[model samples]
Target: MNIRPIEINDYSRWFDLWQAYLAFYTVELSDEVTQKVWERLMNEDDKDLYGLVCEDEDHVIGFTHYFFHGTTWFDSSYCYLEDLFVEQSVRARGAGRALINGVKEQAQTHGAAKLYWHTDKQNETAQGLYNKVADLTDFIRYDIALKP
Candidate 1:
């Protein structure tokens, strides 16, 4: 599988897959929100926000979106694997693995101290794959959206 940065040309089908991804997470975001995410993915000033696409011939089987986050915990930086998905029909076919390995390779090349991300508690299929590659962090995550 070949993995590379996502391009604007990938928008249409990629957005469809992203919508499916949100549905899987039970997120009720609108298409406008997704469009903004696509913009962020392509933001020229933020080159560190990146995505890896797994494809063969003409088919895009999977994608992984990630970003580099500066952290006080590390002298270097960390790669946050924010979203990763393999099409339902292509699950377990190494698509996810290829994307993950690509991100790891990028982090290593950038001298990142680590790569990490969270998964939903009920995502056993992803956990099975993650178990082979990463250790879960002991910390819990919380967020508060800012509103006026």
Candidate 2:
């Protein structure tokens, strides 16, 4: 598998993977939001956001989207791994690990203070893989919807 930063020509392939990811989470995103996310990932001036693609010779099999942000507790920015997904057919083939490691390498190279992500409590499959590669934090996530 080849891991690389998403390029301008990868829109369709990237969108397919993004849709699969949303499907896994049982969510639907509108075209406007999807287009905006693509624009943000590809924006040259936005150093904080990025998308990485994992592909084989003939297909895009996985993707990850991440971003960095400042935090009050640390001087260096923290890396938030916002999304990760591998095609159902390609699971357990190391594509997921490659995409995650790709992000880790980027964080290290760019001097990020930390890298972290969250998975639904019911996602045991993902947790199985994650446990092997990263620590399982005890923190519980809380969210407030500012928009209806």
Candidate 3:
């Protein structure tokens, strides 16, 4: 599998993988949100948000979305990998890891201080891979919904 930055031509395949990714998490997002995300990923002017895709035989098999932001603890920006998904049928084929490594290379290129991501507690399948690729932090995440 080959990993590369997402391009304008990747939308259809990317969308299919994106919907699958959302379904895997049991989350429903509006079309508007999805469109906005696609736009952001495609926008060359948007330096903060970026995307990568893993292709096997000219087909997109996986994708990842990440961003860099300033943190109080670091002098350089921190890279946060927000989403990562690979085709269900192709798990363990290294597409997921390739996409992650692609992101890590980007983070390093941009002088990021660290790279991090979160996974559900019960997602042991994913955690198994995460455990090998990254350090598990003890910090717990909490959120408050602010309605518009």
Candidate 4:
């Protein structure tokens, strides 16, 4: 019911939610890889990444990981919301909204001009919620993963 910035001590709970988020995306990254990502998120030098947790009685039910993106047109940097998820059983209860709005507040704190994120093309539920909070950008995200 409460949303707060993610602390180092909250990793175990955050990990559970993280795994669920990946599963939702049909990803199967190794735990070791995920741990490295956790380290990056907590690094003091990295102000670009901000993580938040949604909790109830010391249990983490959701998370939001956001950061800044360089943009030429705005006075403030663009806020890129990287990840957001709430446990399935708890959907429609506002945890996702809490995490997103918390990201919005953090973006404002960091002097960001706008906040943005991408959902899978088929993710109808999330799109519905997102349209209510922010406008949909016309851009489509494309990725080209590096090959070793």
Each model's TM-score, in the order given?
Answer: 0.91, 0.95, 0.97, 0.92
Model 1 off-target regions past 4 Å?
A: none
Candidate that scores best on TM-score: 3
Which digits, one per residue and each the tens of the lDDT, describe model 3 over residues 1-148?
Answer: 8999999999999999999999999999999999999999988875668999999999999999999999999789999999999999999978888888999999999999999999999899999899989999899999999988
lDDT of 4: 0.88
Whole-model Cα lDDT of every candidate shown, in order: 0.85, 0.90, 0.93, 0.88
Give the range of the ten consecutive residues with the poorest summed lDDT in model 4: 40-49
RMSD of 2: 1.2
Per-residue lDDT of model 2, residues 1-148, tens digit only: 9999988988998888889889999999999999989999989985657989899885888889999888888889888999999989989989889999999999888788999999999999999899999998879889998975
Candidates sorted on TM-score, descending: 3, 2, 4, 1
Give one digit per residue, the lDDT tens place, for model 1 in 1-148: 7888788888877877887888899888867877777888899896757887888666787788888888999799988899998888878988888899999998898889999999999999999999998887789989999974
Residue 31's lDDT within candidate 2 is: 92
Clashing pairs in 3: none
- Report residue 59 deviation for candidate 1 (angstroms): 0.9
For candidate 4, the TM-score is 0.92
